[model samples]
Target: RRLKKKHFVIECDPLVHEGFESTARHVEIPYLPMLVPPTKWKGYDKGGHLFLPSYVMRTHGVKDQKEAIKSVPRKQLRKVFEALDILGGTKWRVNRRVHDVVETIWSRGGGIAGLVDKGNIPLPEQPETEDPDEIQKWKWSVKKTKKANRELHAERCDTELKLSVARKMREEDGFYYPHNLDFRGRAYPMHPHLSHLGSDLCRGVLEYAEGRPLGKSGLRWLKIHLANKYGGGIEKLSHESKLTFVEDHLPDIFDSAANPVDGNCWWINAEDPFQCLAACMDLSNALESSSPHGAVSHLPIHQDGSCNGLQHYAALGRDYMGAAAVNLVPGEKPADIYSEIAARVLDVVREDSMKDPATDPSVPLAKVLVDEVSLLPAPLCLNQEIFFFMYLFFNKTVEDLDIGSLQVDRKLVKQTVMTSVYGVTFIGARQQIMKRLQEKGHITDDKLLYDVSCYATRVTLDALGQMFQSARAIMAWLGDCAKMIASKNQPVRWTSPVGLPVVQPYKKYKNYMIRTSLQCLALRREGDAIATQRQKAAFPPNFVHSLDSSHMMMTAITCKEAGLHFAGVHDSFWVHACDVDKMNQILREQFVELYSMPILENLLEEFQTLFPTVEFPPCPAQGNFDVREVLTSTYFFN
Candidate 1:
């Protein structure tokens, strides 16, 4: 009663089968998901409009809407949410010409050229060695070479992906990237690549979708923006002086605009080459117009902070000297903190070198020829034979230290000074200096470079401590508070000025194995015990970051209400050239308003209320600097 079924088996030729099997063996299998979709699940009302409360609740992943509303006060949430929406809604388009240039550079692997210039040498061939020590050294070299190559490849892939997406978006009228906040309430574009957050090439290839007439003020600002990108001694000049510098370079700018790759390549030498090139093009277009003031422009002029973290610290402590150093108050020229630190470090080195080695126990001594040679005391153990030869050839004597031979400049000490507020360790500072020294192609000897980096790091930190005494006191107080809370097995928690709750997530974690169909997976479970050291060390920087975010959010909201197109990258703010003045006024106003509140006092009060049993130190006393002075301080945001 059952029907018979027929089966067919098909076989290919033996040669074909062999070829297919070989190809299959060489192909890589992707075990993980290759691509992720953008998050677009925003909350909408019955009329399909964005609902602030609903969106916040969904983003925070709170099932109870009422509870979410209670955590973030409704009024504060609305302001932040609206600001984010405004930021996301601003449309952008790619500069087709610049995009093409970027594509050409990427095709030739130009992205990794800087790494090569920084002493990332080519991979070496494997050596046939029987000695175990030699083999071990060769293995280390191979590993380092592989790492550099992998990094270079990764950078290339990232650039290509960005360019591909940009090419696709260029055909459309315009594209908008949605924005969201981190745990600390810092807003960022949700889309990873091809956003304003990328490098100089990315910024150069992007412009506002909408264009406004470049009136007289806008044109002046455009020229200043160009000069700013060029970045040299001219950067510290006043606005009028900057404009004059641009005027003087009119011929070079035009040449760069007309022939980016072939001409003199004047823009190529700028601090931000691609952006500077874009500015040159914008300037050319404006000038070629019969009515230069009436030319349409879409560039966003930037006003960056001068070491913004230190600025906030200075503001919080009301330290006038610190404020002036960071350019939070008025100055004839914009203060250069890095250069000032470099000068202080140089003075310290010279003073130390001038001490008589025989008389002063602190002074370091080294024997050298008496032919008027300036010698830096070597910190290494030199061979006795070499010392004896030097003494025999020339009388042993100490000479003036040739400070000029040492390359201690603003660039050398910039990173150390910048990260000092973030609690960079001594080892970390030394490593930063070492990399800078290597890039400069001075001190090729590994041991000598290490010694110099160690010395420089010490003086750099000492200089920072001396310069920002109030900042140090505040940092110590913050660390102490975190230590106290973390010692009690609780994470430090606080509410930002904008009412966003921030919790330190650093805690001890335990690993567990989970059995899956394919294999066993190890996952980490966050434990109750706090990571006391990390919690203590990270609090100062994290707290400062949250405060800066609050300042930015306040500025964003105010700028939006004032009907100005606005964008921000942490401390740096941007608006159209025409709206720069208005945006500056609003930013200054919001800054003063944000700091007017008793920030540290409120934080201490919150901690006291949250942990009644834990006794905490009182807030540091405020200094005499006036917050209102920022309003008239032209260089505050420059």
Candidate 2:
């Protein structure tokens, strides 16, 4: 006997299919008459096979099933009242409950996994393959290992050798030395007999041999060398190792904002390799020690924690401040070490940026990137607006954009997305682009337009795939173009080491000024006397003022008082100084007094086009010119 399959039909009307089968057939029938096919319709005497009884046929006495079925509409049209009732009642409410449940889960981070079972997910498992033959053929080999511990005398000898070599290198060459002799993997320390120079210089030489830049490469190499007997290659280095390298090279790589590089904002220990070297040299010079070794040997123990490498490029004063916090003795006054370190580090970087590098003729831009990569330390978390602006600054010319004069109309978008500070800024990527553009003297804020131009350039270059090997070639071409534009007065040609210089037609415009000046001079000399005099008179002045008022003003407000103070003797002032105290005080006062009545009125008027309805109370024209009262009132109202 076949197992019975369960089925239930929900009826639209209770009377529709009622009594279709006779009592005898309902009790036990071979098949249900209602479900029988058309061929078996003859067998179903009452209920027609594949067709139900129609109400129209019952009323009109229509005999044929086909004709009866044709009389009824295929799609039933609901009465207006029924439709209205459904709309007004629970049908929508039930659906809304379902939607709410869906929304709740979606808002709570619901994903595809919730609706799926592991078996139904269509995941295919690979068939296991075993290679018994290969396993049997595999051979195991034993290698001899040595475990020799250095005796006390040997260890002492090694340390003495390392220290001596470090001292010798410091004296002979103007190179830095490492503080320790312990190698990373090797049990034996580097022999003093092999290297007379200090550890840091040796590390630099090793790095140079490894085909890397002199900046972070040396530090990274040292770290790796310390970690292993045979140092790992750059590609093979671990992620943590790379970060450690960045930390080590931070100060040298990111010396200033202008020279921003990877790991620029990181804080590390005080006595780093770079600082140690500089400190040693400074101490040597100050003590009038004849030899570097003698100086190093006679130097006092570092009472304060040593300078960290990261501290070398940044404000050492900051490092010293932090160190003082940690190094404080009970009831001891905070040492003035911060000021000293700040002075030293500032002096070092200042002189360094001014120095010309051996690689190129370009002037170092008053700052050195402490790190090789500017955005290396997770640069992706930068603000979108900053990134966008930086992108434009990098890729486009400032002359093409009047962004400073342009105003953003909407308050919300302006504050949240477009403005500086709170606005979204992509730090690393923007920095990369901005630095590139600033090098070309194009620093403007029309970021989107610049991005569009960059996109166009990329698309154009992509089209030129057959002409160029890479996009870098296009950039190199642009760099050359920029050079020509900058040096229009000077003519420069690319020259081979042993071959004659070749003139490039692409760079012919480089002699623009010379050619124009010579042509004008010749015309003046050769033209008729009257024409020459007229030409001379027609020549424009040598210097015309810049179009922008901000730049042309020659002076700017650098300081201000705050909080409704009546002006007595002092007005707001501006001064250029490297000191922090005056600047900080001015900033504090400005922040406090921004809403003074007169200033508020000026601001309201200035921004009237952008923010109307803002008003300012008038300042007293009486004794001491009560600017503070106006400012305070404006502040209170606003």
Candidate 3:
């Protein structure tokens, strides 16, 4: 067993082979071959144990391995060193087997030196130092950029504030200095883009002045004379000087003056557009007309000079108009009457809980009249159009409740529209009179006429409040209603019959047209409504104009029509004018004349072809047929 185990532990040895070419009679290849003897070193050099190849170590017991060295060419040995340089000294190791393999390949066709050259590893470029002054300059530039950004933000904020103040002042006071108006009395120097802008300004002023006291006469005066002054457009005003007459008295005169012709009075008139001279003369005459006792006795001049001074003051009002009087004299004390008025104005603006509150105290003093007047109610009572509209809208709101039909809840409608906040307040104040009338059994619904006036007052106040940014937020709520519907996929119903859908992108085109029309109406361009009517009239005989630029109800109808069309339905309006016979005749003729459908049967056939599931039902030819019922039902269904 010992002998067998020993035999299995036998020695191992590498295989070797040798070959010789047979000598030919005559052949010599022109090639030079050279042998390179391997070189090796072995010793301890900080790294431990050393070993070397046979030719390198040259030990007596080793066989002649010089043949292996002789097999490789001398040129290949240099290539090994070239590869060593690329592989880096740290990773390279010289061994007989590895050297032989490299050498054989290099000698036959390839060289390690070629790979090293191809790598072409480059030395890094040196970094340059920046000059101290240049570094400082860059730092300064960075600081400037930051500062500029802050300044730009500040400027934007200021512009926003200015715009807000300007819009508010425009809506509230209507105090505008016509910049384009030529004091020289000829044509203005510049042509304004918005021709009606001047009219808007004048209207704003008259509206502010009239407030609750506004009458039809006043409104008519504005309509006639608004564009006559200021050359029919918003004119630029020089902001250089202050005018006392304009700031202190123009608003009062506008309110109190009566038209010599028909007692119609407004803020400004074409006859005396810039007549501060005439206004001061009027004030002087009034002062002179008063019994000179209570406060006028200490006058410095006679009543005659007072009147003449009034004229002089009016004529010389340019000095004040062009200077610090627009706000106030620079060094005026807070306790001064002007300063006191300013303070009061600020207090009033702050205390106002209405839509727009004045946040800035530095508003021009001239606008105080507007600020005060806007807090009041309007005068004119609710007319049929406005009352009916609000009634319809409110009535539509309660349609979900069990009722006989979708007829308007007149009581709720009147309560919401006519019995508004101001109306209620007025009613509360006049409770005694109402109670007495009720006890006498003489209190009719007509007693609410006063409430109509109260409602108008509230509406006018609300309209003026819109000039203030805060009051206009009500519009945002109304605006969001559209957005809320748009965010939904289906129609939203407040009441069963009053279904509204969200706005869709496809419907938005027609919606935009309607909105544009309404905006034009609000701007008082009567031609827009007429133009739209003309366009619709071009379509068909039954095309009773359903879209009205001035009627909000009609606009809503248009929106609904567009929405229904997008929802895969078509709707049309034909009041009493389109009776059964007229509609049938029109439909027959429309299809035949327009697209050659001579009879109802022909139209029905075409419709069935278009919509295969549609079915037409038999009906009495004598009875009037509702087109809406037929269109929405299976009358023409295939």
TM-scores for all candidates: the values are 0.81, 0.15, 0.14
Task: Give the per-residue lDDT digits (tens) of candidate 1, residues 266-351.
Answer: 88777777788888999899999899999988888898878889988999999999999988888666777876786677667767
The Cα RMSD of model 1 versus the native structure comes to 11.3
Put down candidate 3 lDDT per residue, 109-182, tens digits, no spaces: 33121101111123233235487877676676667665664454343333233223333333232221111111
Ranking by TM-score: 1, 2, 3
Q: Report the lDDT tens digits of candidate 2 across residue range 209-318.
A: 01111122223222222222111121122424434543444343333111211223111121122222322222223234344222211111111111211111011112
Model 2 residue 148 distance off true place after TM-score fit, in angstroms:
63
- What's the CA error at residue 199 for candidate 3, in Å? 5.5
